[model samples]
Target: MPRPLWTGAISFGLVTIPVKVVSATEDHSIHFRQVHLEDMGRVRTKKVCELDGQALSQDEIGKGYELSKEQTVPITDEELDQMPLPTAKAIEIVSFVDAESIDPIRISDSYYLATDGQVAAKPYTLLRKALERSDKVAIAKFAWHNRERLGLLRVREGAIVLHSMRWPDEIRSPESLAPRKVELDEGEIERAVQLTDTMALDTITGFRDAYRDALEKLLTAKSEGKELPEPAEGGEREQGQVLDLMAALNASVAAAKESRGEAGGGEATVHEMRPSKKATAQKTASRKKSTAQKTTAKKTAEVKKTTAGRKRTARKQSAS
Candidate 1:
């Protein structure tokens, strides 16, 4: 098993469950090093003191809290170590709340809380089962990495999962997101619902990241000194402006139905198809007319150029 980052007790009422916290997620993102283009040299960074104009050693560095623009309070390692915090060595359960009541936006990193020892196993299992039965999560506070953090404790797949949560004031209000509200029509809403239903998935098992796969393939080809493959096409979608909202929704529903192998039967589907087909034909005709106009303009410019050249030669001959 992987080593735990923290070891503490989950304090609830008179009961305490000794637990160890381990990070649940792994970093899978591809990382690159900054190198000089000329010689592929690795870059290095150094910390320098602005007041002294000298590079300082790690031991000389100290933490400071900014008081004002011209002042700062220098805090030492001894002072920070001696600072008092109630939840320093304990995960104190402050309250229990409905799982759904906690806003997901407030959640940050996740960790798994495992029993610290054989003696802690029973209490850990008990708390996990209780949380599962109540369908609620425990809101707790604990000090980790020198800072107190608010966290959520819940049962996931018979294991205790801890989620570090942001402070209540951290979430921003959504008022700035909306410029104005628009009215909705019942028929249009119904058609949108139909489209959503047709495209809905029962599970997330089929979800795939095509970009990640393609990147990995590209790296493999580069490393093997093989020919880089051309990108696969046909992913573009028609991004037409919605001139008629109802017609657009109806067409969307029809297309979704076709994808799901459903027959586009009924009078409503046929009516929807007619307006879209007419709009497409009109667009095509407009494009063709624009292309023809451009071609005619190009021919006219060529004819004018040729006539000017002939007139210039005749003038030269008359002058001679």
Candidate 2:
């Protein structure tokens, strides 16, 4: 387990839960380094001045905020650090609110909390079980990552988990993402909802990261000198039909009911696709096969080129 990055007491009224925050998630995606094409050497970037085209030293660099399209307001780190609030300390809970009241978008990252040296187990249990029973999450204010954050605190399992939520203005509105809707008949709606329900799994595990896995497979094939087949072309999308407000809403409610039915289904899939060792092995094998096929194709191309060159040489010699 990783050590907590920050430690503090979470207080609401007279209750204080002495807790340490540890990151709840980690990303393990492979990263790539840029290389120079000509020499096939690793590429390095140099910092240079935009105005003068001269390389800048680390000591000479300073932070600046653009006041306008052309004007910038430069500030020193020393001056910014002298603010009344310590960016490193204190997660102050300004007010109490029902956890359900907060928007889901506000919840950004979550961290696991561990008890401080001597916090009472009874109070911790009291808070956790009470929140669980009441179905209320605690909303608090804190400083993190150089800004004041509004966070949701909930007792998950035995300990309290803190989720740093983004401010409302920071997230784009749903209006910005309103382009993917389509009008549907009652039958199509039912079928699509049923398919969605069938596709849904209890938890989000056992599934491969389809896009990421495909990308890795492609890269592996390239590394092995394989030729990839072109993807089948997609048919042009037809224009979407407009939805009738009341009818669409009724259909959506029905779809939601269908989703609930899937979630509450009694029967478990006999295959138990996720959490099975066999499924994972099959996926890995598929990736290996695709990469190997690519390598074989490249070798065939090379051999064809070699054979052609030998034939040309024989023809030239005969003519001479």
Candidate 3:
């Protein structure tokens, strides 16, 4: 089992469930240290006082808030600990809300809340069951790292998980980042929807960090004094080429269907653009001209046939 990062109690109404907080995720990324190029000696950073130019130990460092260019106020851990924070020792559930109502962007780090002792088993199970049945998540407030933070509590895989959240004021408005008004036809919207549907999956468990895998391979080759592996071929798009929106969507849909081993003959076909007003008017004028020519040819043929019949009847009457 992993070591717990914190020990606290879940403050649910009048019930207190003692719990231990452990990280829900782990990093598998490879890290490197800075080193001198000539001797490969590790290069390390030293914390030094700016005024005296003296290197300091970790214990000598303390938190401080800057007031002005020449002024700063030093703060001690003891003073911060003694502050009036009700949620210091507990994960206080302020309210419960629908899980779907929470904005995903505001949530950050996640930790698993496990029962601290046998006495906590009953209340912990009760809270988990209540959350599961109601299908709601708990909004909470807790103090960590010398500051109070907004949190979200929800049950995941039969265990309570606390997700740290950004405060409402901490989230920046996205209005300035939005693009200016642009018009799109229904065909484009429908094609985009079709592409999304084609790319839909029930879960995203199959993906892996390709860059990390390549880095590991490169490191292994270098350490073993072997030839490095070359990158795979034919996986690049044409850079700087302007693409039609509808055409791109159609290609994406086709590619997605092909990846899933589905037939892309008919379903992924591109939409034909509608005729423009000028083209429609030209077609109308051409049809009218052709109709008038056909009418003139029919009238001339009838007149010729009528004159031939009149001459033949007159000759027959004169011969009689």
Candidate 4:
């Protein structure tokens, strides 16, 4: 059994269902060590007091808050405990709302919530089934590792899954993040929407992370003492956006139909691409074939020339 990252109770009015929070996501990216460039040796970092040029031991360090440019306030663990806050001991289910109504950007990490024992089984199962049937998600609050967080609780594969959600304040307004904006015309918008419909995947498994997979493979090969030759860099690819609403809707519908092997009445719109993927592949193969044929022909001609010259030399020698 996997160890729980946290243990708490789900509270609703007078109800409390004891549960354990186990991580649903796992990251397996390979990590590397930093080394000194001069001697190719492992590098170590040290923490030292900037003002006094003194290195403090781990036990000597204390937490401090910088109140102003020149002012500082220090506090101990006991003082931190006395800080005014609600008890960080429960997953309080506030209310349920449509899952689709929540913005995708607000989602943080995911974890599975398992019932602790007999007492918890009832409410846990009830909440899970209710959310699943209603197609709604519970917006709950929970305390994990001393910090209180807002979370979205939903049913996933017969278990209650909790997703830590970013607070509205924590998430930056999209407009502020990227200020640039471009308006699209009707035709362009329609075409882009059509393209999206054609590329839509339903089960998530339909899409694969090609770049990440390739990078992991590269790292693995290098780690195994087999360095990969640098890959040829392909220039930037084109991207699209929409401006016409109706046209885009029409295109999306058409694309959805075409994706289901229904590109019947019209020729499959060969995606307009610079050196389209198909054309690039064919060109590369043709170039290889042409190069091989040229090399073979050159060798054959060289042999013929050599043979003729030898025959003439023999005749000249015989006549002399």
Candidate 5:
């Protein structure tokens, strides 16, 4: 059993469910260590105070807030505890809303809420089932990492899950990021939607981290004293966006159909919209040229062998 990150009670009106918060996810990303290149020794870091030019211990560190150009205020943990806040030690349920009403973009970190002990299981299961049956999520507030956080509480896999969320003001407008807009055609949109449907899946079951897998294989080969495979050639170059949206859309739809093995009727359409056949012919010609070169080399080797045999015979006859 993994240790709980936080032990707290969920407050809802007159109900309190004692629960432990556990992280719901793990980082699978690869990590590396900084080292001295000459000796392969791990590099080390230290926390040095800028004023005294000395390494400082964790206990000597203090939190300060800058008020003005040269004015600052130091805050302590005791002082922070004295401040009045409702979400300091409890998950306070503020409101219950339809889950679909909340945008998923606002959600951030995830945590699982498990009952602390056998005695707390009843209320925990009750709340979980209630949220599941009602088809709603509870908006709650809690204090964590010295700040108040808004969270969404919902049920998942017969357990309660909490998702910390960003405030409305934190989300930026899309228009602010992309000021320029291009007009879209209805026919192009229809074809694009059709292409999307052709490539859609109920769930992403085939996805894998190819880079990680290749790195693992490389490390295994190094340990086994084996040679590494040659590096692959560069991938195909990306095409620029087509100004003729209809042609692009038709090509995309045809390509998607072809990928799904439904291109029997789309072959002509795909060729009409794309110059793919010409590219294929060029590739075929290059392969044939390579084969012809190999055949010519083989014939030259045979002719040299025949000429050497005749010269040997002529030398023997002259000597006799």
Candidate 6:
């Protein structure tokens, strides 16, 4: 197990549960270090004082706030520790709220809260069971790294997990990022919904990082002095190309269905839009008017032909 980042107690109404905060996630990403390309030597960064031009050691470094270009305020750890903070050494539960009420964007890093010792087991279990039974998360305030931050406490797999959250003022307004007004056809909306349904999955555990896998392969090939792997063959859409929204949705639905091994691998199932009652009525009226005009023209032509035949017969009788 990893070492605890912070040791504190959860302060409920009248109960105190000593707990240790440890990271709930792990970093498996590959990291690179800067080095001298020609000599293959590790390059290191040094901290030097701007005025004295002397490199400083870790012990010589301290926290400071820049007041201006030429002025700074030095702050000592002792002074910060003495500052008055109600949640200095405890996770003070402020209120309980439905888990769905918290905006996911506000949540950041997560940590597991483990019971510190045997004495804390009972209260820790009590808090976990309470959260599970209530089906709600506890919003708490805790101080760490000389700053107090908002946190969310909830039961996960019979253990309590604390998720760090940003303050309300820290979140930026998304109104400016919203797109301009646009019109959508009902058929297009239905096709988009079908695409989503075709691509839906119960869980995301099957997904893997393809980029990381390729990176690992590159490293392995370099270590073995082998030829580098060739790039995969695929082309992206051309820039500034006008796309048909309905056609794209149809193709997407077909592709998703094919990937899931569903029937009709190559064909897209389109939901045709039903015509409005007024439109249907107008079309019917137009057809009736066209038929009536054609019938009248046919009757006029027949009458003219019959009159011409009668005139020719009269002329023949007079000649006789």
Q: Choose the strongest candidate by TM-score.
A: 6
lDDT of 3 by residue, 1-320 (tens): 69999999999999999999999999999999999999999999999999999999999999899999899999999999889999988999999999899999999999999999999999999999999999999999999989999999998899999999999898999999999998998999999999889989999999999989999999999999999999877454334433477776877788788888999734433323334456779999999999999999999999999999999999999999
The per-prediction CA RMSD against the true structure, in angstroms, equals 7.4, 17.0, 14.7, 11.7, 11.4, 13.5
Q: Write the per-residue lDDT of candidate 5 for residues 62-162, one digit (tens) a residue.
A: 99999996898999998887679887778989999998899999999999998988878888888888898889999999988788999999988888999
Candidate 3: deviation at residue 249, Å?
1.4
- Residues 1-320, model 2: lDDT tens digits: 68888877666567776777899888767688899989889998999999999998899898999999899999887766566873245555555567768878778888987777665556667777877887888777877655688888787667788889888889887887687886657776676566566556689777677667767777888899998635545333333442344444434445555556734343332222223455678989999999999999999999999999999999999999
* Poorest 10 consecutive residues by lDDT, candidate 4: 265-274
TM-score of each: 0.78, 0.58, 0.81, 0.67, 0.78, 0.81
- What C-alpha lDDT values do all the predictions have? 0.86, 0.72, 0.90, 0.79, 0.85, 0.90
Model 6 misplacement above 4 A: 235-237, 240-242, 267-320
TM-score of 3: 0.81
Which parts of model 3 have CA positions greater than 4 angstroms off? 239-243, 265-320
What digit string (tens of lDDT, one per residue) describes model 4 on residues 125-162?
Answer: 88777888899999988766547899999887899888
For model 5, name the residue pairs that clash: none
Worst 10 residues of 1 by lDDT: 265-274
Q: Candidate 6 lDDT, tens digit per residue, 74-95? A: 9999999888998999999999
